[model samples]
Target: MLVAYAWLTLVGFVVQLVPNAGPGALPRTLAWTVLGLGLVQCLLCTGVLHRAIDSYLGTRTVTDARLALPAVLMASMTALTVVLVAIRAVEVGLEVGLGLHGALAPFAVTFGVAVPRRTAALALSGYLAATTAALAAAGLPGADLLAALVVVGLGGLLSVFTGRSSAWYIAVIRELEEARGVQARLAVAEERLRFSRDLHDVMGRNLSAIALKSELAAQLVRRGSETEASVGQMTEVQRIAREAQSEVRAVVRGYRDVDLPTELAGARGILRAAGVDCRTDNGGSQLPAPVQAALGWVVREGATNVLRHADATWCTVWVGTDPAGRSALLVMENDGTRGQAPGGSAGSGLAGLRERLDGVGGTLRVARDGESGTFRLTAEVPLAAGNDATADEAVTDPAGTAGTHGSGTDGKDSAE
Candidate 1:
């Protein structure tokens, strides 16, 4: 825009000079000289505006000015442009000269100059005084002088208003975008806190019981009394260790796969001790990692649910390949649990299982029969969906060791 305006100023000079070039009119040599000077002033005005603006907006790196230097620099240009216009009016008619001033007025306006307030006020007052003295010295009459001051003053003020408004709005928008980024980071931190709370929920109670029982067992050993009581406390510790192991497995199996055979055997052992009589079958096949993982989580979550249920008498788990051998199907069903849990919302654990199955390009279906007091969770994953997982990375599930959860053989009246 600055360059275009400069070209426009040159074109205006040419147009006005063409018809007015003659005796008692604009001289050719003087007209050409003013024409080049006018164009240069227009470009310089544009550049000067950026000096103040770029510093204010941080769009460019600039050293801080002493404020006096900038005030003097800008105020001098204001006085110079007015004096030059008054001088040119002596050759061209005052009306044509002032018309040119109208075109050049934009150059004198400085916005966001970032100078001290007193310096700015003094600079503005100085420019007005210098302009008046220079114009009178150039022989401008009283009425012409007033007209020139009004035109230049109003044009400069108007440009300042426009440029400052734009800079203010740009600064506001930048701050809002920065605030939005901060809000997003805060939300991620909040989610991490919620995840930690879930880990606490999974492990907190079992850990407390372990601490109390271990202390009791140590006391009994020191007294050398009731040896069977110490043995029982240690046995209780073993049971809790198994439950804690399975709980951790259910909490973090989404990252990788678990062994289906190991997981099934583990679940069977846990349920039998609770008198739930759980049975599991994997169809004697080595399924893909993702498929096995999906099914493995089903067994773990199902067994945990059964052991936690008040009247879970039986549960059956099955994992098998379809007739086409292209997809693997998993189904787990248990009697009693959801009827006491209204709306079957206690089935939230199943919702997480569904999400896990979805990651392996699979689907999960759940049904609860309130009348029969039965809950069933079914899942299926495509064998080809996993894309031949990179050589089975070790998973830290309870199956981390072949029968970590099944290590305890003792039965308790109530499931931990």
Candidate 2:
């Protein structure tokens, strides 16, 4: 919308470049100057408008210094536009009457869209009053003054309406984001409580059995009746300990095997909650369980990196078969990779992902495009039967631990 208005303003200036006969050098020069200034004003105003909207949404805090320069430029351009149109109106005598009134519309609209209600309204009122007085001083008739006031008044109202509506829309989005955060925290707390209860259930029976057996063994030893009964009781205690250990391992494995589909949905939800647009495409859904688990970890880590390391506004996660159909590929890409090194040391999360992918006969790649300010993470694992067999063998090997291989660009390869 802002760009559209700017283009319209530019067109208005371009129209002014043509004269009655050949070309009026002064009018053409003024038109070019106004056009250049308007373009600069638009560029600066983009940042100011973004900051203003974010500030209103409670998502950012901007200093006055950031906004001051754009505000001044906007005011200067508006005054110049009005002056130019007023001079043309005096020269052309009522033929350029609409130009005089419409000169302030762009600035008024920008003010309404980017500034707070009271400030925009106050500034617009003052601007209208000044422009009106200037037109009168330039010998505009009383009827022309009334007509200009009506047009300027309507433009100001439109600006105010646009600004207020944008504020309301941003407020609603912020509220939804806050609600999502609360929901996520609640889910974490609930999961913690559930895990604690499971732990207690798993341990309570074994601990009770151990205590009873030890008491019986102590009694037998004190009475000196027999060592066999005491030995048997000790064996039962060791059995209970082993059972408890197995249960704990199962619980941990359950926690670690986060499903790929679930993680993808969660990543989308979480990124959207943080005001980042997230899109995911699952090219196919026939992947093995181990393969799904590995890609799920990639999605989780990529989302975390986007939130913690980048200032991205959009992220895309894609899972598809490689061009050769010999491997499955997972790619996560996001803009705003500021402060991140494209070919620097790998972070712990990426290092761990490398190890996991390697254990499953896969590769991990990370790249940052400095020109576009984007970060991309790519994971590829062969989809052949032998690849699954190799992964299974790797998991079963008692002494074969996952090891990392360097990928040259800020990521590690997880191939054995």
Candidate 3:
């Protein structure tokens, strides 16, 4: 709209230069000056307007002076165009009246772009007052001056509406950005709370047990009871402490197996809260507990990737035995893969998952369908002897023993 007004104003200036317009030397010179000012005003107005938008959107700051400059120029140009027309009006007794009103149109359009509601209104009011005074000074008839004021007055109102509307639109965008930031912070806080809860669950009961046994041992020593009871209590305390230490390690490493059904439900809730559509099929409940644990890790990792890496609008999770019923399968699919390589060389999280799956004779596969802009993750663990044999073989096989003992090959292979 601003561009159109600028072009129209330029065209009006060109029209004033024509022979039929009866522009005298002074009028012609003033027209050219106004045209040059309008060009500069347009450029400066564009920059100022952009800053105004950024300020409103909370992305930048702007001072009143920055906004005032373009608005002042717009008013000046409008007043100059009115002065030129008033000069022609005086010469030809209102017959050549308002030939330059088109030039004023661009300034009117730009008034809204360059300033906010109150500022635009004040600027336009000042221009109208100046125009009225110039017309009166040029001996324009009272009726002619009134008509000119009416026309410019309407343009001023239009500019105020335009500026106010732009402000409202920018305000909405600002609010949305703020809301997104708040949501992200809340997600982080929730994650911290979840970690704390897990730590408490892993250590709370064991710590209580250790405390009770310690008290019992103390009581026995004080009463001069059998040393065997005290020895057993101390031994039990040691065992409990070791178990708690292991559980703490598992929690810290995120290796504790989450129940499949519980993780699926949580995933769906989380995705929905983030404004993503989530669907799940919980058909693999009949699978062995170890298989479920491995697949549950897959779901957890997949959901995390979707939240962290993709701009997904929808996610689907499927868990069931493979068609042959020989393997348990977990599949997660989400749209908006962001063109990232699917399952690109394992990050720490996926690497850990890979190790857990490999321990149970499972494989993790990631597929990216660029044409569909979707990412899919598949985790499959054999449901039969393959799962148990993998663990047993690691325990009994001489080659496995050698790999574990020689050059840390088993550790390196698992890391890969």
Candidate 4:
């Protein structure tokens, strides 16, 4: 926008170059000088804008935000250049109406993108006053001077409104990324809590009984009674210990294993909360354990990538048998890309997914539609030879149009 506006003003000046040009006419050299200064100022304005926004978003403690040193420095340099250009216009006897607006273009972007709001109003006020004084000294009539001020002032304010609105949305995205990080950590912590509870339940009563038996054995020995009861007590303690060790191992195994249905539900809920409308279909209740585990990991990784990389508004997860029923299939797809080509994201965790699926005699394929920006990940783990018992129900609608939904964070979810 700033570039286009600057070019428009340049076109206006070029129009004045026709034969019999009025008081606004300039020598070729001064016109060239003006053009050089404009390109330089525009570059500086662009740099200042980016730096200022980075500084604003980088702030952790302040709501009003502070400008970075580079942004401030570039803005100062651009201001100096603007002054030189204004003086040159006046020296060349350019009319106030013709050249003044061009001289003020940089100020609009500088105020909108670089200046922090805390100082924007005061700075703009000072600038308007200084501009009025400069135009008066150049011998401009009062009416033309006020008109310039009005036009310049309105442009700067509009810039402030539009620029700040964009900045606000950027800030919200930063907040969403932070929130997603917290959600992942909370999921991990919740899993840990569940494991600890399982361990406690398996150990709590058995440990108490072992303690009581040991105490009884020690009391019997102190009282000089027969050793048989103590020996039997120790034997019983050994049995209980063995039982506990087995139960503890089972609990650990369960903790490490992923349940396919729970994972499908989790992926849907997570993507929904992150503002992507997600649909998931867990086609069968009885997939072989290893196939389910491998596909569960696929869902997990695919959801994470979408949250981290995509500009997606929708996602789908489908798990069931293929049409031939010789292979169990899982597919995860989304309609977003961050400039990545189909299969272009292999280095970003796709390789790991491939290795895991390979262990289960499965293959992973990624297909991308560049024109539509759709990314599809398909993982097929072959069913044991001659096994065709799994159903193709879950995949009947590849788009999951009749599937259960994982809703937006604000809305209630429902199965379709």
TM-scores for candidates 1 onward, in order: 0.46, 0.60, 0.56, 0.66
lDDT (Cα, tens digit) per residue for candidate 1, span 232-337: 9998988787787677655554323467788899888866755678878778367766677668887878776766554788888888977998889888888865
Model 3 agreement with the true structure over 1-416: per-residue lDDT tens digits: 44554455456543553333334677666666666766676676556656655665557766767656655765566566556665662243232233334445555554554445676677667767777787678666778767667755764565456655666766875676578678779988998999899999989999999999999999999999889999999989877776675566557646454688998998898788777899999998887777887788888888888777788999999998877789888999999576666555556888888888887778888788877788888899999744575575456343334333433335433443
Which candidate comes out best when scored by TM-score?
4
lDDT of 3 at 74: 57
Q: Candidate 2 on 1-416: residue-level lDDT in tens?
A: 64455446445633453342124566566655655665676676565666666776667766767656655665565455455555552244232333433344445555565556788778877877876777677666777667766765675576557656766786886688678678869999999998889889888998999899999999999999899999999878776765665566556567668688999999999899788999999874787677788889999998987776779999999998888888889999999576666665668999999998897789999888977888889999777643565575476332333212121112321111
Q: Which residue pairs does candidate 3 place in steric collision?
A: none
Comparison by TM-score, 1 against 3, better one: 3
Q: Please, what is the whole-model Cα lDDT of each candidate in the order they appear?
A: 0.62, 0.68, 0.69, 0.64
Off by over 4 Å in 2: 1-139, 162-184, 268-284, 306-328, 332-346, 368-376, 382-416
> How much does candidate 3 score in TM-score?
0.56
Cα lDDT, model 4, residue 170 = 78
- Candidates 3 and 4: which is better by TM-score? 4
- What is candidate 3's local distance difference test score? 0.69
User: Which run of 10 residues does model 2 get worst, by summed lDDT?
Assistant: 407-416
Whole-model lDDT for model 2 versus the true structure? 0.68
